[model samples]
Target: MATLVSILLLLAMWWLTMTTGALAISPGRVVATLTGGGTRIENLVIIDRRLSRLLAGSLIGFCLGTSGALTQTITRNPIATPDILGVSAGAGTFAVLALVRPETTERLLGVSTTVALVPVAILGGLITTGVILTLGWRGGFDGYRLVLVGLGINALALALTSWLLTRAEVEEASVAVRWLVGSLGGVRMGDVVYLAPMVVLAVLVCLRLAGGLGALRLGRDIGQALGVSAGRTEAGALITAVALVSVATAAAGPIAFVAFVAPQVAMRLFGTAGPPPLASGLVGALLLVGADFLAARLPLELPVGIVTSVLGAPVLLYLMTRHLRRTSV
Candidate 1:
């Protein structure tokens, strides 16, 4: 109920933000615009521009949140997330590469560069995840080892991204920087159209696997005893998480920490031991929309990822300190 209310409030804020800007419109006018009863300018600004951005931000948030919850559950670690596990970094690196070096990707993939971003990003994320899993596997998945490997891969991906940026032309490099920072400024309805269906499909798969994922928190042996195929369940969950993060990264350039922070925040709000995938997705949507709104309102408009990182950094520190203290004890 609280989550529902929070979502409603965020939706209201999102609508308000979309409707009002340089040329302000009232909430009533925004509603009328949505319902097809607004001036040409209002329609152009609200329907064409802001609505697309809002939808993109919301979907990206939902994907990240859902992916984050699944990742944390899979690893049995509160801080585990796609970003920390190098999935986002890998996706971002490949997407930027595709953007800056279109002909190379076009030649390799036998497709238009425009059509290759999501697929390349997904491939990168999957490959990175496979490496992390392989390096971390020791008879069974080890949380600490997985995190360590993921961090190393993340560093490597970042270095590669920096190198790629250096290779880009000045204009392409500027575009890459905005993408790296994660903004919705360039998003359009076409981008939303590409993102929404993938998110919906991934989300359906997540809902179907939610029960098995919940069982995973009890450990592999117990989960197997409960009739869950530990291996298959883990594989399915990881694939879904990778797909979710990949599409989200492809859409918004790897918005940082939404995946890491949203699930933890949802768990705290609901007072639950395990991350709730659906609720966490909603929380993520709210967080991103709110962050985008705040980012736009800043003296100089900032990337939504910058805002989320600012909010999430302190939370990350808190979680790390708590983890260290618990381990020390």
Candidate 2:
């Protein structure tokens, strides 16, 4: 009931800002525009453009949030996020490469290969996740080593992405930049369609592994003592996390901070003692919806990623401080 109320409250807030064009429009007029009671242009602006983008942003946030929680919990590390594991970079790389491909460009917006951008993004994400997990698992997965190796891989993937961006055409580079900053602008239902299946799969995989995640919190050796196959559990978690982030990033670029923020928020709110997957997903949806709503109202018009960063950075700092204090104690 509380969750429902919170969701409604957030939605109301979104409607209020959008209607009032807190960023630009009068509240009543925005509603009229969406309801088809306003001018054709208003309908085009509000319903066709803004609403679709908002939905996309919310969906992307949800995907990243849950995936991040799953990864953090499975690894027993507060710092674990999809970005750290190179999934976002992998997705970004594949998308950029597709945009630069002549066949893809000629056939579609930038490219027209038999292989679509979504699949390429998913495959890349999976490969990166698999490699990171394999490297982290030495006899048994260690969270400390996992975080270190994941960060290294993420850095390498980012370097490759920068190089690819340089080699890409100016138009492709422009597209890539928008993706990097992670905006929901200009998104359509077709793009959402491409992301839906992967998100569903990831969610299902997470749900299936929830029990294992619970055990993982007690450490791998203990989990193994309790009949949980640490290797399989870790592998499943990595795959799910990668798939979710890959689909989300592919759909809306890498919207920075949602993965990190949502899971942390979930852990705090639920007092899970670790990550809370379901709570993380709900928080993620709310965070994105709220952030996008506020972004929509901004005069200078910041991207959703900017909003998330502004909100997430402080939380990250707080977490670091807490971690340090705990370690010293």
Candidate 3:
């Protein structure tokens, strides 16, 4: 029922995305256009343009949310998320490098400047995650240590990104800055196609592992008693979360806070003790789509990340305060 509500909300948000832009089309006309019965202008605006942005946002959000669920489950901590894995900072560093100094980045990466950003960003994120995993693994995974180690690496990556921006000309840095803030503005159909398979596979994987994840969250002894291998589930969840976030950061330039906020929100919405990957994904879609919608309409116009951060910060504060109260009790 919670998932159903989330889906309905997501659909409603998508409708708003389609119907409420400049030169507004009615909801019925938008549906007709989507179903292939509208004028050229409507098709151009809806199909060729808006649809791609919406799809990209939805896909990115789903991946981030699912990743967050997996991470939170493994760590048994609401605050643990893909953001703590250094993926965003690493991806942003490489992306900024590509945007601000395409020639140097291309030479270093041995890819055409045109295609270097995504792949380079992916490489950077993966490399950063690998480094974190290496240093933070203490006989078994230590969630707290991992977060701490990842923070240091993430800081370095963000610092590198900042230095690059400062050295580059403003024209070169302008595009980099927007990408860092996480906009769906540049998303096109091809990017959506690139992300769909991974997003679908991630969801399926999450579903398949859901039971094990739930048990593992109860603690190791109980998980083993329930015939779920705690080590295997933890490792699988961690790997999946890392991969999903890396790919998403590469694709969307590190949209802020979705991975941190989605799973916790899902848990509260569903009144569950643990995050449900499916519901988290749905809420994530709603959040990003709604953020993009709001971003488009706002007079001060900002990136989707800016909108997400604005909305999510208060939620994070609430969750933190609640957690503090529980611990105090």
Higher-ranked by TM-score: 1 or 3 = 1
lDDT of 2 by residue, 127-195 (tens): 787778788776666767887888888888889888988988898788777768877875777776766
lDDT of each: 0.87, 0.76, 0.82
Candidate 1 residue pairs in backbone clash:
none
Alpha carbon deviation, residue 53, candidate 1 (Å): 0.8
For residues 38-122, write the lDDT of model 1, one tens digit per residue: 8998899998888888998888888999899988988898777999989899989989999898778899999987679889899
Root-mean-square deviation of every model: 1.5, 3.0, 2.2
Candidate rank order under TM-score: 1, 3, 2
Cα lDDT of model 3 by residue, 141-191, tens digit: 576787788788888888999999999999989878877888888888877
Quote the RMSD, in angstroms, for model 1. Answer: 1.5
Per-candidate TM equals 0.96, 0.87, 0.91
Identify the superior model by lDDT, candidate 2 or candidate 3: 3
Global lDDT of model 2? 0.76
What TM-score would you give candidate 3 relative to the actual structure?
0.91
